[model samples]
Target: MAALAHRLEDDDHLSDADFIKISNLIGQQVGIKLPPSKRLMVEGRLRRRLRALDLASFSDYGDYLFRLDGLETEITYLINAVTTNKTDFFREPEHFELMQKKLVAELIAQRRDRLPLLKVWSAASSTGAEAYTAAMVLADMVAQRRDFRFAVLGTDISTDVLDIGRRAIYPAEQVVPMPPGMQSRHLMQARRPGARPEVRIVPELRRLVRFDQLNLMDESYPYDRDVDIILLRNVLIYFEKADQAKVISRLVGHLRPGGYLLLGHSESMIGTSITMRQVAPAVFQKT
Candidate 1:
């Protein structure tokens, strides 16, 4: 068994047939396009699964994945393995700046007759960084405006990333991009004798944010229909144009009229056909 395990690890490359099968399923299910250029990356990510399943190679993993009962149970692990979760606190500083300087204030002013509770959805909220970042900004607003209330909902397709988001603990370096003074205010350090330094978002901020597993390819999302702001940033680049339109249309359905949708800077060109107008670079207001 030991020798077999060693030999299996040696045969690490994904066969062409297996690559096609896996890539097709990923596109169909998650809407992430896995071009041939991504073959090496896909193989690298799947090796961990190969080790976990004690499979000999990508071909063997593929065989198991396509078997009668393999797909239904293993699909979650597959998605988690391939879906990218590259995120940082305050990754795009300008978006949060807009939220803090103008968007939140404007939304609050528009709804002053009622107690305004802002609902911010980090639509592709990988590991909760974006959602928590938004929460930190809004929490600061609440510090001054006692009447303001907010909740953040973070959704992602990868369960592994969602679990990390729920835990709210990250390596100390990941918090460096956060605005000055916000770190000390919103994060709690976890000190141990010889462990790598880590920080957990403070309970006050974590209480205002939550994470859930949600695939964007779903026909409809089970979420509030009147979300005040939706941050669908840095995610649409993964989908084809058709899929991109479908996703934007679906997300727009959830946004209240005059609500805001913020996309990544690179994704600005893709939302022109939707029922929203660009009010700022990568920022759209629902019509």
Candidate 2:
């Protein structure tokens, strides 16, 4: 252990060859592109894994990662370490506005007869913010229409983020982006003495949303085909165009005809091959 610690102290940086291997493996497993520009960022993130595993260097970590037995157990930790999970309550306010003003009513009217329950999928939900935001919006709608009912599914490649989502606890400041009154209605504060300032989503709202581990690069997802709305936002920028299109096409298969697909503002140009018409900026509907 002393020698291993000395070796780790001597080799602190990720080697170029090891970085390339890691970048390629990440791309293959999760459809994320990690170019040379991100080498430092990758090294910074993976350092946590090295510390966790007590590995001597990036090369040592790489050896364990590529081995079949180690790969099976370490893949989740690797993805969790490197994946970017920037999220906040109501990150894009306009998307929620559109949901409340137009989409929900239309979806409910369209499926009222056969399927009364509206299903929403947050395809790249990071820490449950987007999914919980959607739930808060839909839950508000239920007050106006007694027949309205909904379910939200939040999926991400990082199990770490999903676990955070499932817990529904966040720092108190993270709720600032949420509209007035919504916070009071949906969040419970942790006010005990010496407790850090934090808030948890109310039980009622948490009940309406569920988080799951999912990789968009997989050939198929285990979800229902009649989803009413799918939010694949802010994540496609990490992929190559081909992978982006493939992911969009696969997600479209899960939506019902007339269901909506919401993308990040920058991702509007891709997914042209799919039979979906643009309904709003970064929003599309199946034809």
Best by TM-score: 1
lDDT tens digits, residue span 24-60, model 1:
9999999999999998888888888888998766767
CA deviation > 4 Å runs, candidate 1: 1-11
Q: Could you estimate the TM-score for every candidate? A: 0.94, 0.93
* Candidate 1 Cα deviation (angstroms), residue 249: 0.4
Candidate 2 per-residue lDDT, tens place, 1-287, comes to 99997676556887777788789989999999999999888888888788899987777887787743587888789899899998888887888899989998888888747548899999999999999999999988887777778999999999899999999999887898887788988999776824558889999999989998999999999999999999999999999988988899999999999899999887777645557888888889997
How well does model 1 score by local distance difference test? 0.89
Clashing pairs in 1: none
**Model 1 residue 10 CA deviation in Å:** 6.0
Question: After superposing candidate 2, which stretches have Cα over 4 Å from the reference?
Answer: 1-11, 67-69, 193-195, 271-273
**TM-score of predicted model 2?**
0.93
- The collision pairs in model 2 are none
